[model samples]
Target: MTRLRIVLADDHPLVLMGMRDLLEKDFSFEVTATLDSPTALVEHLRRHPAHVIITDYSMPGDETYGDGIRLVKYLRRHFPVPRVVVLTMVSNPMIISALYDAGVSAVVLKRHNLNEISAALHTLQAGRRYYPPGFQRDGAIDARNKFIGERINSLSPKEYEVLRHFVRGESMMQVAESLKRSIKTVSGQKISAMRKLNVQTDQELVAFCVTSGIFP
Candidate 1:
């Protein structure tokens, strides 16, 4: 059989070239194109479709959109959607679950190396769903503003981890333990974070995370 066609989209040039070299060397994949923007990737797809698209979630863009999540959704909606594999530093539950719901084929935390990408691609090619195990853990919520307009940061890296765990049915103690922190510390952080975000409870925080793209 012919090798599967693939494309890469990430703002990091070195990372993009490195991943391309790895995939082309190790797999039955033929990289058709590489791009730095989701918009450009979309335009390329209209001309020549690929079997898979490996995109970075944190790709830099104008103030309008930051991650490639929106691009994933667009592809899923357009006719002849290609299988998508999102590579991101973010492993938050809100984002992962939403991408899954949007028909993303795989979600891999970018911390994984070229070997992991090969494994993910192989698994998907074999007709199985792939989600990097242990995506979210009991994490704390950071309320420092991200400086993106008037929006408060809402969640720090650690806090986002806490938010993901709490939203996924974990409790305060469970979250603290998973995060290797004290219960009181986690509790205080959550409460303070909620206050800053103007949210009163865990459920509300979860809802906000999904809607505001704060953690997701």
Candidate 2:
């Protein structure tokens, strides 16, 4: 039998090491690479192929391929062969839905046993999407999550950047400077994001971001 080729990427060194050990212990899985950043993963994929790619949702410090939905989209666009599984601590239904929409094959919450990673890979082998337990508990919850997910997805890339900066405690001027946009433009983007998210104040926007796990 052929072993499943796997690539693991995570920002945390300990988490990456743990995942490598867990997957390697399984005789059917082969970890071809363990990367710590989005850039490294992309570079590795350019030269090596894998059957599965399990990665964290947020691996900050890679400006070329910013984390979250952005990184997922990039991987799907550039390397569509490997199945992508997101292993993250983020539990916000809105973000989870967004990740699925971005074309990941599975999402396993880190709070669960790491063994779920193997289960996720098996589900992918069967050509099915895997969701964490209780991810689709009821119609009412799905409806609410769908509504918020739509709102969150409506933000343009620039608008999302504005919110990410704000959540990181950056001032409006700081964000504007960093993005090379005028203060007015940055503020406008912030307002637009707030409107889409139905947040009325800066505090509310930050609170929503934190609770939604958009930055985490």
Candidate 3:
């Protein structure tokens, strides 16, 4: 089997290590280079071509190539345009839409499990785009802003995790135990998620979850 040549770019050491480990262990990839900053990434890419580039949008870089949209645009314009998989902590719909417009093949939230990364890479390899559910490359302007109002995409990673347990009918205590967090912390995250979803009561929250298909 011909291994797919891949490049990784992230500022966080732990995240970079974790991603490298996950890709090497679970996927058919050959991670030729792992770069800590956009400068290094650009430098490496100038000398070597890769099949895919998995990068974090908010990593350290130069003024021109500094992370987020600028770096993505740089990659799109300069390189041969390898399949770009964006693993980011930013869940803002506007920024994500910009990434799609900038030629990002897949956008995976860092909060999601490695499975999402695999799914994204598969989709990109098959010549398709991968956006989180409820997000479209070009949707209504109001709909884009309202996405945060109705979708979990507005929630922080931790809050999203808490909501996953809450929708599964888990109590705050159970959720805390399962997540190895304090009950108070779990409750706070759940409440925060609810606020982001614009739900003021438990009944409304559960209804939202059910209607959103977050719960079976």
For model 1, the local distance difference test gives 0.71
Q: Over the full model, what C-alpha lDDT does candidate 3 score relative to the true structure?
A: 0.75
Residue pairs whose backbone atoms clash in candidate 3: none
Tens-digit lDDT track of model 3 for 61-114: 243466666567788889856878888765656567778888888899876787
Local accuracy of candidate 1 as per-residue lDDT tens digits, 1-216: 457799899888998899899888965988999998877787788899788888887654322333444556677777255788888866556657777887888888876666788888888889887888675454344544333212334344445555655765678987676566799988877777677677876678888767765544
lDDT of 2 by residue, 1-216 (tens): 567899999989999999998888889899999999999999999999898899998676676777777788899999999989998876666667878998999999998999999898878877799999888564445777777767776787668767877787778897776566799999999999999999999989988888776765
Candidate with better TM-score, 1 vs 3: 1
**Which ten residues in a row are the worst by lDDT in model 1?**
145-154
- Score each candidate by Cα lDDT: 0.71, 0.84, 0.75
Sort the candidates on TM-score, descending order: 2, 1, 3
- In order of appearance, the predictions have TM-scores of 0.63, 0.76, 0.61
Query: Candidate 2: where are CA atoms >4 Å away?
Result: 138-162, 170-189, 192-200, 207-216
Between candidates 2 and 3, the TM-score winner: 2
How many clashes in each candidate?
7, 0, 0
